[model samples]
Target: MFEFCADPSTLETGPWFACYLTNGVHLLFYQSFLTVLLLLAITAPVALAFGFAGAAASRSHIAPLRWFGQVYTSMVRGVPDIVFFLFFVIALDQALEWINHQIRCPDWDEPIRQGANFTVCQAAKIPLSSSPQWVHEVYNFGVAVFTFAIVFGAFAANVLFGAMRAVPRAQLETAEAYGMTRRQSFWRVLVPQMWIYALPGLSNLWMILIKATPLLFLLGVEDIVYWARELGGSRTSQFAYPHPDWRLWYFLFLLVFYLAFTRVSEIVLARINTRLSRGQATMAGEAQRRAGA
Candidate 1:
């Protein structure tokens, strides 16, 4: 906070506004917006990769791998998202600590779970009990990212799997007739064409992913929502900055933020759809050709 903001008791509107916005916590609050964007940027590709692998495995000839992929893709739809978010963080965290406990606490033979408390040796503690604040934040962030990826990966798998199937079987047969093996045809023919079909579904998934970023709070990552709630509430005169409850204004800012981002996303996806449609056999491609002629 600025020196003028040190005592907000007598400050005029402009000075108070300046200090309130510049305060340390407010700075963190602003950065949390970037944190939301960063999570989406990092998670999208990773989840897509995971989805690709799952889709491929589901289509595999092998029984067990196919079953695993089917289960992975279906689980997201079957389980409620909020339930998954709440449960996965604790489950994943404990699972990580348990693995560490088994390796690091071999000499100590104590029940890992006693009543409601789960205990692991200090060595097994993630970010260790004595670690700095940043370590905790980083660990929490990692957990949030992993959770988001796992949940979204399943949805992506469903989209890609359908897209792969939408690729014309005749195209694959033509590749085979040219002496290409199944693997060769898949990479050279089917994979290339599936994107046209996949784009629509994946675009929808991207919108959902953007909307889902707010769930970062459920994972205990202090995200924009958390900050908005904290900063918008009434601040007593005893505090450095006294303000009436402004949650409505703060949330309105968030609403506009999402609306603008999603609007841009729609425009970008439209251009991509247009680019991908060119020369394809779809109606859109035919229209494009007619326009050019």
Candidate 2:
């Protein structure tokens, strides 16, 4: 901020605006963009791993394991993702704290639930109520990221399970005839070929994930949406720079950001699909071979 910013009321238009945008709050606003990217970077792979596990479990020969996997994948699909996000963060947090409380304060006489209130001993509080402010923020962001991964993972599992099934039965048969075991055939033939079938659904899931990043605001993470609402609210004479409401512009920027993110993802995924299809027997692969020849 400029030295002239000392007297915000005395500053002229450009100077006030300049100082306003350069303030510490604006730096936090900019960092929120990185937070969004961080969330995406962490969640995507975690969700994919969860999906892979779910899909593998759903295909298990053991009846109980298969039933559990099938139920998890199916029930998640039947419910709205946001509902799970809202419920799970609190539920998981409470579950963790309760378990911690039992171990850390076993002698405490008070029940965790006192009528409408769910209270735990101070020692058991996540991040320890004594921890720094940033610790709490980081803890909340972790919860949000985990919640997003779990909910989206189930959907990914569904798409991947179907994709795994879509790989031709004849291909597996051919691999077996070539002296491959069932497991060998699955890894060598089915797994490699299923990706093209999965790409379209996975692409759709990526777009949804991009859009869902805004829901971080609901989860108490100080994401771009949080900053947009905070920075764009009308500022009166009480604040450093007085301004009318600018929330619409802030939200519009968010809209453009998400649109660009998804657009780039679509282009990248398309290129990947093309590369993956080059030597396969699928329609796209066959078309490419014909064109090249």
Q: Model 2 segments beyond 4 Å from truth?
A: none
Worst lDDT run of 10 residues, candidate 2, spans 81-90
- With a 3 Å backbone cut-off (N, CA, C), the pairs that clash in candidate 1 are none
Candidate closest to the true structure, highest lDDT: 1
Error of 2 at 216 (Å): 0.7
Number of clashes found in candidate 1? 0
CA lDDT, every model vs. true structure: 0.91, 0.89
Per-residue lDDT of model 1, residues 36-155, tens digit only: 998999899989998999999999999999999999999876898899999888898899999999999999788999999999999999879999999998888888888888988999
Q: Give the TM-score of candidate 1.
A: 0.97
Off by over 4 Å in 1: 1-3
Tens-digit per-residue lDDT, 136-207, candidate 2: 999998998888888889989998899999988988999999999988987888888888988889889888
